[model samples]
Target: MTQATHRPASWSVVATVRASAPVCNLFARHYLARGARQVFLFHDDASVACNVALHGVRNTVCQGRWWRRGRPDALEDRQVHNATKAKAWCETDWLLHCDVDELIWSAQDVGEVLGLIPDDVGGIVINTAEAVYAAPPSQHTMFRTPFFKFFFDERGRPRAYRAISQQAYGDLWNASKYGLWGHILGKSFIRAKADVGRMPLHHKKQERINGFLMRQQAPQLVLRHYDTLSPEMWKEKHLRRIRSEVSVPMAGRFRERQQALIAEAEARDGNAGLDQLYLRMSTLPPGILAECLTEGFVRVIRPEAHLLAQDHS
Candidate 1:
């Protein structure tokens, strides 16, 4: 077995969690193992954050009735709050701004990935590959576990995944290559915090709020995002955001999709229809993962992860 090369102690990650507390810990653990020196997690559940071994900022940022109501603004509020705090807390040379479910994967230690940004650059936009999975091993298993990933973007056909129940592993496909929100890449890290006004939910810098634009998109560094991890998880998450801010004035494909999903699901078979939609979306498994390597849907983890070292499940 090969070990990862030594990494610089100049990187830290900042993440915010609403209900995915355990997964946040999983995120922290994986990043730390991957080379990030420190990880700060902000959440509403103090008890849940307490058990996780990282800089736990419990209830400090994620607290509010908005999350309970499912306000989209709540996500913005939590991210901005933690992004600022991370700027203050991060003594490292650079800080990673990403969500709990969006884990950035790199072939080399992340220090190498961050090095791609020239000294004049404030940040780098990392390409994202949505990690595809199958109907989770069970509800007991966490969302987007690496073991089940096989493809990215949209390959196969809708019928392929819908057919998983009958055929465990045949041809799971993805149809879309772009993100639901339109942009496929997102700014995941920033070395210059002084010019940053606030962390925007989707991208970095938030327009011209920052004086200079030193951010460039790096195709080599990729972020594995479980945005719509599963129908059950997606429903639970977005429903809260919808409920919290049905009138929050945000308009986009994400919001529109959530609205339609909530309405259609409720009117149809409760959440059953939504669950099936997700199950169909997540039809790829390890067998297809090998093929994805050839097609560029996913990349193999570089030194591989010590799966048994820290069990966040």
Candidate 2:
């Protein structure tokens, strides 16, 4: 239960991860190197195979108890549990809840971000943007084509519909509840010192919930999402998500576009069936791609675009 004494000036990132995937480890390494003081890895599955392969790093692994059937009411119960544990182990004032797939980038260092945050400010709201990509050409390791990018508006709202963009700020309370997406919302923030048991703001959400968090505006930071890393992963994850149910209402259009993409991919590389699916999904609406390139968040060098254009031509 030892905690580090060093607390930086700005916000401290509090990341909660399952720690089973290689991507999670890569995320930890990248953020730790970039000045993240503490990272909490909540091990939901206590089986021997579930623990991450991180060695000699500042992290706490909490082996979560098994749930025997009924749906758990709290979505981010694990995060709340881990955060409480972190608070007891290491006393800290601020927490930044983020996921492995999301990254916070800034021109200034971590300290600078923290410095901008005022002590009176209970929490800060950040925005997320989806990074899309087309399929890679033959023998290439990564996707090469540029697609349109989505942006979040000033009030921490996502322009495109994405559940992860909405978040909250507060300390542990008794009645706090986690939503379907594993985020806690609709709770009173405790202004004074209070014990965990006595706090009424515990996490508790009765029904499925999603959307934005209300808070003061702050400097812009990108929450780059790599949800669609590949076409195969895209189809698998998207189809499996709760949002997939929405597509059923729009089934005809979905099927038509899906078939056309499949045809295009097969035309390009039959063996690359997965790649074809990815290209179609990642293709941004015509003008959006150019807008993102002009903004410089996307790397659309002239030669690469020229080669892609030639191939299409």
Candidate 3:
């Protein structure tokens, strides 16, 4: 019998976080369990608790005060700086830049996925699937669900957008042009040792040192973004933007919609307005979820919670 031979590739992940300790710990643990060689976490805040939570996790590095001269004004600028720093120091074959709320959902080992790509490809563009609430969520709910809205790359076929338009899903369809509340460009895995252009927010359309385009979009591995899993999360995220605590880009329809939502949220007292907007746009009723699944507008990706638990055990 001929034994199956798997090509060897080492990959790492990096994220700049300003979240709770548990959230930081889970983000590191999940990728480690998913076969990441190393996980680099740059805490945007000087939180001792978040750093301490990751201290014991094997093959993970947590850093604070990563900025040398001074911190950048925009959150995305900070992320790009940290990611570039990680790429310089990472010894792995590839380094991925992602957010703390995002997780890579892969059916196979991440390294194996990269190993299949041609050597000439300098970067890989992973698409995203935004998480959606299958049923009404409670106050404490946080990404504890299996439903996701997977929008395909419209570079070729416009099938995904056509399907969403056919739904006439009101606020849901009109939430963003790509039918996602978050970025449709997703995250990226840049070749660690390869000389490439400056890392942008999305990290797609990367050019090589020779000024040649070398970005390859791989739709197989999906970046599962838990942008807003519950009403509390939704409210707090928008509030941060409203208060100027977080920096969102000035351009794009997404930003315009976000500004409108922030204004609406501030107009109403308490969490009522945010809660209403969340229900109308983010959450999915049971019947609607089923119908979406049946029509192939949404997909059920039940990532294993035990994957991270096993590492902790």
Candidate 4:
């Protein structure tokens, strides 16, 4: 058996979760195994301490009273806090800011992705695509109702949208401006360096343009977001966020949205529908869900493709 070789890269990963979730722990293990040198997990809730202890993973814990004057303002505070920690602790030349629910996959090995970064570039903008469900029943899995493409900026506000790609070579993000009503001012800037090259960060909606004050690149890599998986997990995460003293305005809005989604899912196929969505998802070919939601129709790289090739050979 060939041993997996770890390639040194300039980037590190940072994530923050208020209450502990099983999915978050799974993501941490996956990233750590994939060659991320450093991983930082931040939580303000003391209850999460017990959960973290069970995992036996060493992490930095930030304990304090968390409160938000309003919903929108509170969401931004969390972002700022995480960014502040990343700036303080991450020693890598580049930083990838992501949440536990978001998973970034590369067909090429990790080293291949790192090799693409140029020497002169400050940051890369990644394109994000929201995955949708095509009807049917499955067990344990939840499907995305085809609502809006991630690129459709007008459908949803930007703050709710998370970034899978963020570089932290020189100037780190200033967390104070996160979730502020105005434009993202002074938050997404990196120091210019001779080694930085033209790289793009892909979000579900827009591509960050290259050479401009803010550089964006649309790489072939994909970020699969499993935001609506498992009703129990979803409910637990949202309820915790909504109950938080800091999550006031946004929490209320989130609750409304959650209720609506639940109603819609139940009405569509009943409890059976939810069950089918989950079960079918466990068996569906890879990337099929994402393909259904893309604007221009693209071929999904299904797991069956590999199986078929082997069978033919």
* Model 2, position 260: C-alpha lDDT score: 52
Error of 3 at 154 (Å): 11
User: Mind giving the per-residue lDDT tens digits that candidate 3 earns over 76-162?
Assistant: 787888788788878888888998889898887777888776676667878788878765564334556687876673343434655
- Candidate order (lDDT): 3, 1, 4, 2
lDDT per residue as tens, model 2, 1-313: 1222343442344455543454455555545555555555555434422334444234544443334343234435555555555444433344455655555554557555554543443434444444455433331212233332444333434332222212211111111111011121212221111232221222212211122122434454444445455454444434433334222232233344444554555667774775544554444434544544554333332222222322220
Candidate 4 ranges with C-alpha deviation above 4 Å: 1-8, 19-21, 50-58, 65-73, 131-213, 239-313
lDDT of 1 by residue, 1-313 (tens): 1232334427777777654545665677677777887777777445444446465322344556535745344445657666776778777777777777777776666787666454545556665555555444332243336632322334432223232322332222222323122235464577645476665455664432344444566655667766665566677665765666323343455456555655666678876776665565555555655565454444444324443444564
- Model 1 / residue 125 / CA error / Å: 0.9
- Give the TM-score of each candidate: 0.70, 0.53, 0.85, 0.54
Give me the overall lDDT of model 4: 0.41
Error of 2 at 123 (Å): 0.4
- Candidate 1 Cα errors over 4 Å, as ranges: 1-9, 44-51, 55-73, 137-183, 192-194, 205-213, 245-251, 284-303, 307-310
Q: In candidate 1, residue 55 scores what lDDT?
A: 52
Ranking by TM-score, best first? Answer: 3, 1, 4, 2
Alpha-carbon lDDT, every model: 0.55, 0.40, 0.69, 0.41
Q: Which of the two, 1 or 4, has more TM-score? A: 1
Given candidate 2, what's the lDDT at residue 284?
Answer: 45
What C-alpha root-mean-square deviation, in Å, does candidate 3 show against the real structure?
Answer: 4.4
